[model samples]
Target: MNSIRANPQAGLDIHMLDVQFIRDNLEAVKANCKNRNVTADVDRVVALDEQRRQILQQQQVHQHRQNEISKLIPKEKDKDKKQALIQEGRDLREKVAALENQVKEVEAELKTVLMTIPNMSHPDAPVGLTPADNKVISKVGEPKKFDFKPKDHVALAEALDIVDFEAGSSVAGQKFYFLKNEAVLLELALVQYAFGKLLEKGYTPIITPDVAKVDVLEGIGFMPRGPETQIYSLANTDLCLIATAEITLGGMHRDRIFDELDLPIKYVGMSHCFRTEAGAPGRDTRGLYRVHQFTKVEMFVFCTPDQSDGLHQELLAIEESIFQGLGLPYHVIDTCTGDLGGPAYRKFDIETWMPARGEAGEYGEVTSTSNCTDFQSRRLGIRFKSTKQKGTRFVHTLNGTAVAVSRALVAILENYQQADGSVVIPEALKRWVGRDVISRKGGISG
Candidate 1:
């Protein structure tokens, strides 16, 4: 990796960091962004880059003249010549300082714009702006036919006395809820079941910190210290609540290099992730679909570039197996370029069929896997050394949602609803949940 060149590939537009590289391959960078569905202001990045370069050039010229004039002053014995050299050097210094100041301003502006630009889309990614544009590669199982009008999770939670949205809202504002009775047991069972399965698959189980430093958050591509985004920052510290376990796991190996043999270091991290939901104020506030804080089992992998592709697919398979074990109907969709996050090189989302969330029985995304090919590693300075390969190379990092317990609970409740307002648990999880269906075997009215 060239220190001066930020990845100036044909597909990547040059930013302040990659100005020199972008200057050499300007057309290629613009073309790549276009092909990747990255709607970057390529023209703006290019123009700012040129301005920064011109300012830098002007500063360099002034510094060179200043150096030459200083050397001449020592050789010139005449008073008038010495005075002239000193005056010339002073003028050069002033000009250089002004030009350097302009360069700094442009560089700062370039960073703000470049950081917001989305990563280039994978060539295979479909072209679309929203989830609606996502391509469904496979649809598994079928939506069950209901004999009666099924109550939504919110209604069922109230009717069955399994959740307390009112008390939660009263205490902690809306979108917060307490899982009561069977819902509590069900949540515990789900977390343990998912943890056991990942342990069986040789993943190192760890319950990570729910909060991290702002620098760590930024290293993982999250703007933790910003006010415009959805981060929950601490009052006086440089810390912020982590939006996902991925943030903690991503920071675990920061500024450290790994052995090549440890190439696919898999982690099964459980944490209570927090989000402010800044951009989404009213959306999904009805139930457990969206919330301020929720427990999650996240899967993160650190692998070499050659190993990332297969590892990404493997992570997706693990997510699918978990859903399949739950006996829920789901579809795997290839997320389009526009829908991918800033660090994701490619992404795949598994949307489960939910009958109550939206009109006409919609699907809700339960889990997603992303291949962030060396993007986060580069930012975090994580690398691996291979004996066969010459030097250390940045490892490709990937993250997958194993089970967001809340949303999975939402899907299971809504999709497996019985006519009597009870939810049937998947047969495979009966041993863990200790019940086949969530119902008051006695009565709803205590």
Candidate 2:
């Protein structure tokens, strides 16, 4: 029932938005909900908060009367008078207990209603209903014009004996595949390449747990249990398999209060991500483009409010650098309000050109960076104390995909495919992959 309180020590009563803020900005909050395509009753939250306050006042009054009766009972000399005072005290105690219970019930209801409300969107974010409405920021590097028919990742992977879909399906059900031969090497190289880039940016590298507690997931704005949830929960346990390293990284500092000097704490996390791909039936179902599980390198940052905007752009720039290093052609997108996740105030995505996507070629999202702007930190109870400020304040949180190995491979393979059925590895990853190209005859050779 304590859905929002992940940090017991923090004593944080506020979730995404406190009742007072909702009351003051009632119209704005309601409009944000509409813009984000979220349905929430803003008025109900205010009503529940008022009801809870009233019950608490009544409970305090009865508690005070009970205390007074107890004192009188101890001093009274007459036996009947003493007994009557004790009885009165007992009656008052019952009334106080009943009111206390009502307060708790109302508080639970209030939190439940608040959970339905999402974080406010950034003012600069475009207001739209779908991906079509998202604004294009910039396009980088031109898509390659192939002299011959280029194969999609599936055909390229299968023809070169780099991935075994049948075995993967037989072993782990559908939407799973085995990386064979050089594909295994490619995944490792991609991770190493991303890690190297992040390390250069002074990011601490961490290998995070693939599974996290349900509350931790919720604290990071993920629904771990529901019909629409893309998360996979372990039966008979409160843990769920993580969909991204962002969940574990964000939960890492739960209930923590850092010094202002440590305002920007950056981490590059590596983890195996799992998703059910719920409601995504047939769209991009083929190959590694849309899969149930994959390896990922994720970037997470926690910083003061003033530092978050710059850090968000920095994350996006890192993502762009990684893709650009791989020689992949891509474009940047400013995500619209409706396309943004519940915790993201603003988001930007890098869509890499995949050679065999449509009839000719198309852009597909490979990485994204989001500025949550204290939305997640509030839920996770992560705060920072400044030398100038009196008390601690919730730190802003941001996450970006450094590299999703599966999708990165899809882009690399399709884009670098040659007429002779060979796929060239990017120069940046050549050292780690230990080869210049992957072909049937050479397996992996220069």
After superposing candidate 2 on the true structure, give the runs of residues whose Cα lies further than 4 Å from its correct spot: 1-14, 63-89, 444-446
**Alpha-carbon error at 266 in model 2, in Å?**
0.7
Q: What is the overall TM-score of model 2 with all chains considered together?
A: 0.93
Instruction: Tell me the tens digit of each residue's lDDT in model 1 across 202-259.
Output: 9999999999988678767888756766788889998898889999998899877799
Candidate with maximal TM-score: 2
CA displacement after TM-score superposition, residue 138 of candidate 2 (Å):
1.1
lDDT at residue 340 of model 2 (Cα atoms): 95
Highest lDDT against the true fold, candidate: 2
lDDT of 2 by residue, 1-446 (tens): 23233344644454766567889999999999999999999999999888877877777777778878877877899999999988888888788778767876887788778888888899999999899989999999999999998899999999999999999999998999999899999999999999999999999999999999988898888887667899999999999999999999999999899999987999999999999999889888789999999999999999999999999999999999999999999999999999997899999999999989999999999999999988888888889999998998989999999999999999999999999989998999999988888887875543
Candidate 1 residues lying further than 4 Å off, grouped into runs, are: 1-25, 31-39, 43-106, 225-228, 441-446
Clashing pairs in 1: 11-32
